[model samples]
Target: MLQILNEEGEVVNEKAMPDLSDDELKELMRRMVYTRIWDQRALSLNRQGRLGFYAPVAGQEASMLASEFAMEDEDWLLPSYRDIPQLVFHGLPLTKAFLYSRGHFMGGQIPEGVNALMPQIIIAAQCTQCAGIALGLKKRGKKNVAFTYFGDGATSQGDFYEGLNFAGAYQAPAVFISQNNRFAISVPVEKQTASKTLAQKSVAAGIRGIQVDGMDPLAVYAATKEARENAVNGEGPTLIETLTYRYGPHTTAGDDPTRYRTEELDNEWEKKDPLIRFRKFLENKGLWSKEEEEKTVEQAKDDIKAALKEADNTPKQKVTDLIKIMSETLPYNLQEQLEEYTEKESK
Candidate 1:
């Protein structure tokens, strides 16, 4: 495992820093702040019954943003449900993300100019998709690559190995990020698999694998940037195991984590919070301060408020339209079903 930064706001290795400028560093902090605010808003919206399903990323900003910021705009991203923050940074609009939480059809569609697929809902299903897409990009001789995110739990799924095997066999330009937040919903990571480290799983496939301190954004960024460089250089895929945690319920469906986790455990991870560590690092460099953080928070609040109003203004999807968009030409059964539903609803 590689740990460039420690828990107490100190850098352990200044020599292994990633190629990020001071402006970029400040931007990263701003993004993490904005993303944390957005996470809170989404959770509140879910509680108020104003939004549908949501996966909070409150405590995983460093893990998510650092790796995501490492990618170029042209690179591919295959995200999971909890990865909406990275997706937004990669070109997804905040409003669309809000719409996604509302379960609106438009929210699921990949808008123009974005190179990401809809966040995978079926766990590791995106792994194979990442492999398949990477193969296509390789065959086309494109410099771009594809990377996907899954949790420690997804490593146990069949698709996870299959994707790794396929990419390794052909040396496809792909990257796999396993956000080891220590739990796959109710199941703790210890019970999920026998592997001592998730990154070593890539060894079996003959690809590179590395572990990083997910709480330290700089380490994650450096690892991801190196993985991407290696992959695009035709060295094939790399698997990154990010050691982080989720601060709240896995989803807003009322899964009380206390059933399987202890409050002591949460408090322990709290001591190593990503935001505080990064803020300390930046402040030491004269790149950030408490006053700047407050201003950023206020700006984020206004921006989120405007986004909420925009999402509210967006028209709701009708059942008839939903069924019609199911296909270019609705199949006979679907057409019948659509007509029946439309007629029933008209009454």
Candidate 2:
């Protein structure tokens, strides 16, 4: 696996280190801290019954944020349900993210200039969509790429292969990232597939494939940066498998990871926590301090509070509102239902 920083936060592969400026490195750290804070707060909100349908993102910050850090604002991002951090960082409003988890229809609408789709709830579906988007960019002579993310479990789905095959055949400018957190909810990686490495699956699609230590933000950033470059250069797509872990349950909807995960295994992965190691690295370089980190934490909390308030202030969606957006001229059945709901709501 590709790795720059080891578990102790020491650079093990100096040659593979990304050539990022100190300020850029600091920005990446700040974003990771903010994302982690947001993830924690979202989970709390879910527990408090303020937010619905949340997937905890405590341990996958490097895999999510670092890869996104490598992308340009113009590139298209096709994210899976677990990738809200990437979407928000890509310019989707945080309030929209909250609304989405709350199942509000307005959350689905992408603001102009934000090149992203709402998080795909269906497994592996975004793979095909990303392929199509990449092909469109190529046909239009755009220099941008389409970047999509999915879990290791998604590789077993038919759409994954179909998407890669189509993108490879068309030489579409795309990058597909698989965050192999070792379990598809409760199923272990060993049970998911007998394949030695998830990255090797790309060979069948005739694309470049590589594995990276997902806990190492620098490594994740480097791999994604190169993948994006290859894509924009018309070299076709790449499949990147990030070896990571999720410290929390699969979702806030009553998943008990303890039934499948052992204390030993969890402890092992905890030693490699992305935030701890990355913080150590920055501190060693005289780039980060406890004071700065505390400030960032406070800032994130305040921002999340504001975003949640905005989400709370949004007008509650009505059935008629959904019907109106479904079509400019509704079908007869929908029209009748809309009128019924509208009239009932009026009362």
lDDT of 1 by residue, 197-307 (tens): 999999999999999899999999999999999989999999999999999999998889899889999999998899999988998999998888999899989988888
Instruction: List ranges where model 1 is wrong by over 4 Å.
Output: 344-347
Each prediction's TM-score versus the true structure: 0.97, 0.99
What is the C-alpha local distance difference test score of candidate 2? 0.95
Model 2 segments beyond 4 Å from truth? Answer: none
lDDT of 2 by residue, 61-180 (tens): 999999999999999999998999999999999999999999999888989999999999899999999999999999999999999999999999999999999999999999999999
Q: What Cα-based lDDT does every candidate model obtain? A: 0.92, 0.95
